[model samples]
Target chain A: MKNRYDIVVVGAGPGGSMAAKVAAMGGLDVLLVEKRQEIGSPIRCAEGVSKKGLKKFLPQIKKEWISCEVEGARIYSPDGTMVEMAEEMAGSEVGYVLERKIFDRDLATLSGDAGADVYAKTNVTDLVLKDGVVKGVKGKHLGRSFEVECNLVIGADGTESKIGRMGGIDTTLKPIDIESGVEYIMTDIEVNDLCNFYLGNDIAPGGYAWMFPKGDNMANIGLAVLGKYLIKKNVKRPIDYLNKFVKEHYKDGKIVSVVFGGIPVSRPIKTISNGIMLVGDAARFTDPITGGGILKAMESGIMAGETAIDAIEAEDFSENELKKYEDKWRPTIGMKNERNYLIKEFFINLSDEKLNDLARSINEVKIKEMSVTGLIAMLIEKNPKTLENLSEILLKYL
Target chain B: MIYVDRYKCGYCGTCVAVCPEAAIDLLETFIDINDNMCKACDICVKICPIGALVDEE
Candidate 1:
């Protein structure tokens, strides 16, 4: 006899955990499986989350998960031009650099508290299907293979989710759309309680370097380079570039931990099939412009959870029914991702010289408050001459 | 032997940096694999700064 669940969510990241939480809350029998022995252990992220976006989904911030409360961010040009602003002025600026271990555990606890069965070290190796409708999952844990049945399946695995691909959802991303990221947790550095962004070709070809403050003397320093750019330039690893930047920028710091990962910058794919729905990085739910997905993952997980309940009650686990989850989010959350893709294209094609000039122009503006969108627009408006150049570059690359 | 496309090398020196055999000479635009000194560890092939170098199978 096989074990059973109303919903089985693969990957116990923020998205999967949140989906389990919502489904279990709605009186559904939910099971969450994570491949890692511990959730959030091999920290692969920069751990930054905007307060505004976070508040839109989660009612309150849990105290234990916050590493530091940031006031705003400083944007720097290649030659070191700087533009500083207050968090209130930029809605997306004020954020918390999280302790993801605590954060991820809390989400799983939320699911378990809501009556979901959570399993770590259980790897979902394959999807079990009956006549083109997903019926369950085949996995291994503790050196034993098992099959677990579920009416609906939610795939929230990260960038390398094989579960989504097995369901035939066309989840493969182009190399140019995937960012190969490397980061270092460094100590003995003096940093203000604000995030710092460095932009220029010298640091990253199609992405930027970030210094996210964790404390007065420690920070997460990292860079994201498009994988295509890495291949194009024949670099050894993205972290090598990050290390050079640290030596030049924060000379006194010593790296304590190094992490490498990838961020998907593509718009959310059409990620639903019969009895299946994909959420989080598996669906490329990450914001293309900023590479932030924790909040988006949580939002989509909530939607997926509620939708899973409907599918289970209908007893008709069809493609059309599962697609409602995608439809509900496609217009709002999906649209934002599409817009951010355009912005990412505009930023990635800029040369180091152009970025420095753009930064200088931005610093000259007496703007008090701006959205990340608004700031980019202001740069274009102030330097009308660059718009044509930007358009040309965008046409060639995007 | 390792083959390199000269055009793609950005001289980021990653191959030189990661080479355990110290067989690569960091150049302005690329690295020169010293065959005499090269042990063919394949680290340079994996860590090529621009991914310009490939090992012949």
Candidate 2:
């Protein structure tokens, strides 16, 4: 560890690593820190990302990083009515299940090769704020404490984003907008090439269940319940929800690995502050509908990296200069997030009867492709009552 | 009182972010919840996916 650097990126996840890589490649001295001893171990994701989403950033998908390549998706309603769609129309976690342990580490290695000082087992305890402007970070590396000054601080910290809070950025998520989730890496069950999504308030209130195959006969089975749903009787921790899912579905399956996490299912929060920027889950950039952040994390990282260089060249690290980072993401990913949030809100509130009806209607069409516009038209023709309770966007058309 | 069941804990740090008081801290493999700052909100308890965080009996 150095005493100073041009920029300091907290967390070694994909977002931070990409930011550090881009900044270092641009000739800026960068420091990347990860609290964990290993770059990626204790996997937190369902490990699924759209094929096109990953392709936008990486040159090519490495074979080892992929566990499975799904061709489409299967969405089942409470009554078991199934609506199938090709991968092109699948939301976020459809196309591929990645080995994040390898993928996250490789990204950090790329940043290191680009001249960023990447350090694992490094923890950022606090931000060095000078008059409410983030000046640097104070933390420990291998049992040694140090304070390093920097012109810019990029917080790529995930769901539990203390870095953003320490830098005076509010990253609070309401119970309705936060999902408590768990997953089990199960084997000894027949798996298919398509990802499966199950919906019903009875199965997982305020959320949904999914099974993403990971090759062979293994699959990742998981479900998340929004915080708002937890307050209801008999619904406590997400483990209970996962247990219900396993009992009913994967009862004969073997549990090899158990994982727990919380996904922020909210629209984008403020991502930039004075001399500070947040990327990935820290910025609440995860897709509101799918709770997927891998693609958006990399997107924000690239923008943050470019914005950092722009600020450095202008000799201005003020919020005014850093605003470009958020501005860059707003029109692109931000709009989609807001729209998805509304759709998620509506979907979660729907009755099981409605979900089953919609599923049957969509399945009946037997379409080759699933497009939003086409689905809207089909829904209006087949199930007009369901559209009556839609949010602002659809109501305008009605 | 030990509120954290270490055996069940995965330490993903979800409790730390959702803490309204900012009372919880994730330290490597373990998570520390500062009692002084905690208000027994049970938010972390309900949200803990693995049932690692339990409400004090």
Candidate 3:
């Protein structure tokens, strides 16, 4: 293998693979490295995405990648009352549950087919810096020390991003900014063709528990709790909450798989510097409201790849040139992420009574005709005095 | 044996995710490591973000 390339993308998740694919297709020598032996083993996500979001990036998605088609979602309040809304009514366009293991590998394969060198089991230990500019990476590949020289490095390494830190970016998150998540893939329990979200402080404590059906008798059930709330409540882990949920809701289900990880609900940090850029979870691009990141990751990865090509061709790999990526994405998803963070803060502090009241209002209204903003508006209007703070946050979006 | 520093554990469950033996369990108050199932591979030690898991001699 060549010891040098024009670009090196760390991590083989959706963001890294998409970046590598786009750069290689643009006729650049790109190397995509993954720490794990397999590209998609030990999946860390809930494996859910919207059809429209998937189509925006990979227009020709294969049927094998889709695990199930969801027509709508059912949200349950703390008091056991449920509000069902169609995919169109939700306005987020989430209509599919994905088999992420298959999807992740397919993306890596596409990157390879597009002329990028793909290396697995390559753990990047440190960045190769010169004059405080990232020049490449040094790591171990298959138990042997290896070095790869590159003009630019893209850090797509999820929530616990080492590359982002090695490049002199502080990727630390306060307890409140991080969501500690745990999930289980279970079978042998019948489920409807809709995703389910259970909201209440008693149920999740500053987060929400979800069940995404993969098939007739299989589902990915999980919950993410605010780290701050966990400490305040003396809860040691999210697994206990997940275990309790499963016992109460699906006692007959059989556990098939387990996944645990952290999701960053904070706003995206200043992620770009000379010769280094952060995408995906490394950049904290996950949606604060839904904790969904697949779409945003792919979007940012494509933008980073295209930006890298432009920087390479221009022969200006300075920090100013790389700012183009931030300039382009910030106005789009970055702003949305900031808005969602505020909304998350507001919702996380709501009491069970307020949540129940919100649910009752939704149930009484015509939810099928309401957009996300409209729903928020209705909540704000009904409890004008109680939801006054939320109204301020929703003003721009509304 | 795997020693867990209960105070430091954030309970993100990275140890459980990487454990080949599934020896670690996050209970309501702390992480429980099944000694019978634990192979002492030390993957948990390396993966812990907070240095909560340690290999006891």
Best by TM-score: 2
DockQ, model 3, C-alpha based: 0.09
What C-alpha root-mean-square deviation, in Å, does candidate 1 show against the real structure?
A: 8.6
lDDT of each: 0.78, 0.84, 0.82
lDDT, residue A346, model 3 = 88
Which stretch of 10 consecutive residues in model 3 chain A shows the poorest summed lDDT? A365-374
Q: In candidate 3, what are the lDDT values of residues A1-398, reduced to their tens digit?
A: 58889999998999999999999999999999988788877688898887877898989989989999887778899998788777454345457799988999999999999999999988787889999887788988888998888889999988767666677777766667777788889999888878899998877877899999999899999898776665443344577788889999999999998777778888778888889889998888999888999989999999999999999999788889999999989899888898889988888888898889888876765555323455677777778898888888888754
Provide the lowest-lDDT 10-residue window in model 1 chain A. Answer: A389-398
lDDT of 3 at A54: 89
Residue pairs in clash, model 2: none
DockQ of each: 0.04, 0.73, 0.09
User: What global local distance difference test value does model 1 have?
Assistant: 0.78
Of the candidates shown, which would achieve the greatest DockQ relative to the real structure? 2
Better of 1 and 3 by lDDT: 3
Once model 2 is optimally superposed onto the true structure by TM-score, how far is the C-alpha of residue A6 displaced, in angstroms?
0.8
Q: List the residue pairs that clash in candidate 1.
A: A233-B50, A234-B48, A234-B49, A234-B50, A234-B51, A235-B49, A235-B50
Task: Report the number of clashing residue pairs per model.
Answer: 7, 0, 0
Clash pairs, model 3 backbone? none
